[model samples]
Target: MPGFNSEVRKSLQKAFTALADHYGVPTERQHFVEGPPGKALADFAAHHRADVIVMGNAHRKGLGKWVGSTTEHVLNRVPCNIFAVMGAADQ
Candidate 1:
């Protein structure tokens, strides 16, 4: 997490918290992750016996999308499933 922006990270976390809270989902059971998201997600799912991973994509274009995306990273390797939804591009 060196050179990481704490403010941005906190803001992103709050967004998830707010969404979960609205649906009465327990924050206590939520998890935070670092490093490669695909590996972390797959490992967490396997450990927890989770049936699926739900995520949003910023819909990267051109080079970054072709080079490799987190979505592609986990698609074939995960033990379970992934449900990716489209969202506005990251600013």
Candidate 2:
């Protein structure tokens, strides 16, 4: 639903702002892009010529690790290096 998408966007924006503030990241350095996760990250990194993309990954094990992970997709598509932190599997 459009309403649901709007709510999610607002929630993400709020969380982004909060984290940026807590980390002392300037507003100009903070970006809240709305798109498919992997594609958005890849495109942003390429456009900005980023040296590295730091992200959280739900580090999976075995066969599960090779399938349907945004981190994997970004790793393959992004032009820059990636530093992935292990996050909860449910992510």
Candidate 3:
């Protein structure tokens, strides 16, 4: 699972790089976050003085619902606005 996640991240990085290059945007300002979703997101918002937090809502079954512990935690703790993108499965 970790290997798969790593590959997915690499693929995302590649896609983001291509998009950024196409737009003449520097990648230095882009932040790739990989950590416990809730705490890490909160910390990032606080440190960066961010006004919004964007995240994907993975449609997980059973135990995965509880895994939203991160989202819930962040929603409760963070002072910024939260935007959640629903997964295709969720739609």
lDDT of 3: 0.76
lDDT of every predicted structure (CA atoms): 0.72, 0.78, 0.76
Residue pairs that clash (backbone atoms under 3 angstroms), model 1: none
TM-score of 1: 0.62
TM-score of 2: 0.77
Worst 10 residues of 2 by lDDT: 59-68
Per-residue lDDT, model 1, residue 30, is 69
Candidate 3's C-alpha runs over 4 A off are 1-25, 61-67
Report the C-alpha lDDT of model 1 over 2-31, residue by residue, as the tens digit.
Answer: 457999788877887888789888878767
Per-residue C-alpha lDDT of model 2 across residues 1-91, encoded as one tens digit per residue: 2345777778878998999999999999998876778888888888889999888755577755544478778889977888876656635
**How far does residue 89 in candidate 2 sit from its true spot (Å)?**
7.4
TM-score of 3: 0.61
Count of residue pairs whose backbone atoms collide, per candidate: 0, 0, 0
| Candidate 3 residue pairs in clash (backbone atoms < 3 Å) | none
Candidate 2 ranges with C-alpha deviation above 4 Å: 1-3, 63-68, 88-91
Sort order, TM-score high to low? 2, 1, 3
Model 1, residue 35: C-alpha shift (Å): 2.1
